[model samples]
Target: MEGRNLASINYNILDKSQQKLTIAGRLDMENISSLWPEIFKLIKKNKPKVLLLDASGVDYCDGAGIGLFLKLKEKQKENKGSLQIENLKPEFNQLMELFEPGQLSKPEQIPSFFKRVPEQIGKSLTISMREVYSQISFVGEVFVKFLYTLFHLGSLRWKDTFLIAEKSGANAVGITALLGFLIGVILAFQSAISMRKFGAEIYVADLVAIVLFRELGPLLTAFVLAARTGSAFAAEIGTMKINEEVDALTTMGLEPVRFLVIPRMLAAVVITPLLTMFNNLFGILGCILVMITMGFAPITLINEIQHATNLTDLFGGLAKTFVFGYLIAGIGCLCGLQTGKGASAVGDSATRAVVSSIIAIVVADGIFAVIYYFLGI
Candidate 1:
């Protein structure tokens, strides 16, 4: 080890290889700025394949220090280096845990309510209620603005739709399939147990058919938008915000809402139903897989589901999903508009967008449920 001792940081260049470089040091907020220029310069000069930073002696690192370190580490890829951190202290360990946390991480870990998906959903929903209730004009404006958006939508060129469909579809397909199949499996398993107790195990197929087509289709499709498409919108619009394109649009006398928001919102309106149908198909496929393992006759399962559900179940779910598409797009675009001064704002806005979309979807689902039940279709 060759030691080049600076004030608080003692840089020990441990080894050098074609594929990697190793450095061990104590990095604190107080000393970080002094070493950055030299450290950044070394990075530029070495251009190694990987950079292993052994921060075993890092006693303290504030947000600024942590921020700088993350930036340097992020630049590693462009420099052909993969930054791997080791020997983090307890505080640093807690930070990592917060960023990438929980037992969903480990199979046997049952996760806490506040930290779990349910809690996140509840929290977002509560916020949504407050927002919607706080301003009656916002709801009126949203509806009016959406109606205005619809008229301009029909005049929109076909190429815009095609570009949007390709991007939205490709982004959302995988997560939608995985989550849809999982929900289907759990539904079939749970419903089968209940139906079996009632000597109606055959009804498991009916639940999958009706419930998936009508409810889970919209629900899952909206969640997919919350995760996949909403994040993308925030990131894209965020980059635009970062680049001042949104501001430029205003200077040019163009409405950022009409030019940017309309395309994505309309795309969601068109594509979500298509995705929901796909989700329903995959969900059914998953249930079929479960059926095979449960000693249910595949032929009988098909017959019962076919007889139990009709156009209403299939079409109703699809229709609800179309509404969800609008909600997802609307919330995402709104959050993007709220993005502020920096990359941190982009990240923060994207998170808010996803959380808002999920909450909006859940609330919309409940509203739709009430409407559908009273209609008694």
Candidate 2:
């Protein structure tokens, strides 16, 4: 019964083939060795049909104690006799649960590749469908708020809208112009090489103008915005979401979508088309520079561009820019608003916003291209 003493084991022979082993005191590392000899001796000599281990008297047990029980259980199994544990403490029960053996000897059977492929595909489809539903619902809510703000002009946050426009549009002008100019220069250079073979280098001007105004201008502008402004939007809003500012706004009866999203959306819608137009102008400027270097007159280049491009081409590109802007802004806001909890969630949202916006822009551009082709524009 002394605290320093090892666990004491007492045996009670119940019958010819039945026996009980009572363990008392602590069964930890320092004390478990004392109980083993008696247990083994009884097992070897009597080889009882049933061994009942009464652990009620045990005050504490450790890993060693659990190992001892496992050894006893294994010996009982070898003798084809059952080992019945009695009066186990709740704490010991928990310990046993933690150390319990699983069926590791019997490995799990993996399904065949063909069987797994359809299952994976179905899971992917289900996830994709859920994401689509979430995005559509978010878009619908934003659209309703946008319309309401339009009708009630006072409700529109003009100051925030202007600030966002300035940041997303004005700050981006330099990069947009540079990219546009480079694209035009590259296109003209490539085209002029082929045109020169046929003594039709003048046609490079037409090619550059048509391509820049009808396709490259809008598409390039969208990609730039998606990478720059779209990611920023998501990060900014996602930070607010994590800080509980969005929830605080909600508690204060201010709709976060209306207050935060509407301004950014409007800014994108108004600024993207203007930026596209500017991109087109800069691209043409670059083409002119190239053509002048190639011994073509500036006036001649201007005339070619004027002749090759029309109102339809210009407006079609602008319309596509508008759609791309809306999608980029909307997707960014959606990703931000849907951000999960954690430090990495903001970065994840930003990345998702950029990727999703670019994808939406590309898909929307393709749809526009098909529609324009059908309409003969």
Candidate 3:
């Protein structure tokens, strides 16, 4: 967030103890370095049983700052101590949501893996999966009616489709590019260390290209789209559900599933793979640029990149995007279709849709990973 806002963070300790330390101020981007020294100093001074980061006064915290909290948590845990972050604002709680793997929670909520296993396993996504298959199957019937409603090629729903496409693709231009670029840089940068040890640093280009094009591009693009357009689609449909428009369609002998769900599902099917392909291409650009900046020749980078990734991998990645697209749209629309008759229900459905789609995509990716790894595809 500091990078986004062109700002920084600086925190201080007001009171200290063998087991706790009261901290103050915002942990933004700029002043993080200054704050790090202070934290280490406290660690050196008392090696306290635990670090109680007093974020009671903290107004905001960015992603980078979350690392600081994690470090303190880890350090204390290593010594059989516990770290506690007190007085977190409600808004800050969302940032610590389980969107990513291994996010932290309140100190009291921490538990051993064995104790957590049953709870985690009990939270099955089977209900969500059933909803998706049923709703999306209903959508397929609607698509046929929709196609025949207008002309063979044109439909009244084209505007909605276009709007959705623009929202999902056009508006996402900057962020997608940024994500792709970052992915390329990260892939190559990490590979460079190992490649350099073997005196084959140029393979970093191949590493970046293959990884980005074959996996990261589609996964990241679909993930972001699920967060953006998937949520919006679910919210809009769910709102209509709560407002009785769905009921009105039923009364009028029209199916809400046909009119609403199918168009959204089709739009996602069309757009997600295109977005994923574009992501891989742009990420390759970033990879090439970064490699050249690191003193590799452009021609060498291109040659190596081409040789590294197979046509099968390229096509396989595109296929994964299609499956991911289906999962996101189906899950989102199903969630919307399930919305109860209340305004609050619409919001809850939207939030749940995004979260569920992401989880499904990630889980599906793991399944794909296992298939590819074992089958040697």
Candidate 4:
């Protein structure tokens, strides 16, 4: 080793392939400012494959000193060389550990849009396929657990089911009634305007009854459930997942689907149809008000409504509620169970639950319409 001593630091030419840098005295901003550029120049000139730093003689170090060490390591990295810090005191070693050289690496450049397009498509497709698979698997598990709960009624958590039902259904009564009433009033008023020209203004009752019973009432109720109840379920379950409570339950031999999901699903199934019926009642009340303003008696409007819609219409809409309720609850629970780590995970899960529930409800409603149409319901 050919060693040369500087004022407070030592430089050593160990070999052609390796170099040694010895740091000594107080390493602060003043010392580092001068030493930094000198070290960089030597490292650049030699481009040693391995650079060893001996910090045994380092009397003291501050933030600037720590920064200098980090910079030297970065320089070696650019030269495709390794830096080894040796003979550091425990405290200095601890300070060195606080900063990792990797953290200072230059960020990679973003690829061009054209270059990334195929990668983006492939990534999206892969994610979508995985999501579909997860949903299918969750559905199967829920179905199996539901069947088990059905056969063993005692296994269902009745208390939790009642609480969720109250929250999702009873607490939502005001908004549901208001929305349904407004919808009916709007539908009736619009229909009456068109029918008035033909001297058939009273047919507005028939139109309102048919549309609400066959389609809008249950669909709107499902939307409310998807937004309110489904989002809540997702947030609750996602929080539980994040806290590792779900894992704890699994460790304790409790099925998370059975314990957490079944109650919410049952609550949704029972409450959704009940809420739909309330929505229908309020909607009809709104229709009655509109018809009375048009000089039609309340009894007359009721008679027309009865004649316009039969049990098939009412029951068909209610049937869709059952399926909609199940899907909303199931999707919410599925999203919650799939929650990932990080600050935004719960919020993301809730959003996915609401969106997925709405999509599923619409798709299921369409399928139901087709089946009902073919069957002449």
Candidate 2 residue-wise lDDT, 275-354, digit = tens: 99889999999989999999989998888888888999999899998899999999999999988899899999999999
- After superposition, candidate 3 runs with Cα above 4 Å error: 1-156, 373-375
lDDT-superior candidate, 1 or 2? 2
TM-score of candidate 2 relative to the true fold: 0.70
Candidate 2 regions with alpha-carbon error over 4 angstroms: 1-126
* Residue 16 in model 4: lDDT: 85
Best candidate per TM-score, number? Answer: 4
Please provide, for model 3 over 1-377, each residue's C-alpha lDDT reduced to its tens digit, 9 standing for 90 to 100. 54443223334443454354554556676656667777766676666665566666666577656666767777787767677777767677566563333755656866789978876675556666776677666556655664565355454467876777777777887888888888887777788888889999888887777787678988999899889888888888888888888899899987776567666766787788888877887788888887888898888888888899888888878888878887887778778878887558988888988998999899988898898889787
Question: lDDT at 370 for candidate 4?
Answer: 98
Model 3, position 360, has a per-residue lDDT of 87
Candidates 3 and 4: which is better by TM-score? 4
**Candidate 1 lDDT by residue in tens digits, 228-323:** 888888778888987989999999997676677777777888889888887888898888889889888788888998999999888887878887
Ranking by TM-score: 4, 2, 1, 3
lDDT of candidates 1 onward, in order: 0.75, 0.91, 0.75, 0.90
In angstroms, what RMSD does candidate 1 have relative to the true structure? Answer: 18.4
Candidate 4, residues 1-377, lDDT tens digits: the string is 21222226777888988899888877878777788888888888878899899988987887888888888887788888999999878897788787655555578988999989999999999999999998889899999999899899999999999999999999999999998999999998889889989999988998898899889999999999999999999999999999999999999999999999999998999999999998999999998998898888998888888888899999999999999999999999999999999999999999999999999999999999999999999
Clashes of each: 0, 0, 5, 0
Candidate 1, residue 140: how far the Cα is off, in Å? 6.1
lDDT of 4 at 218: 95
Candidate 1 positional error at 235, Å: 2.3
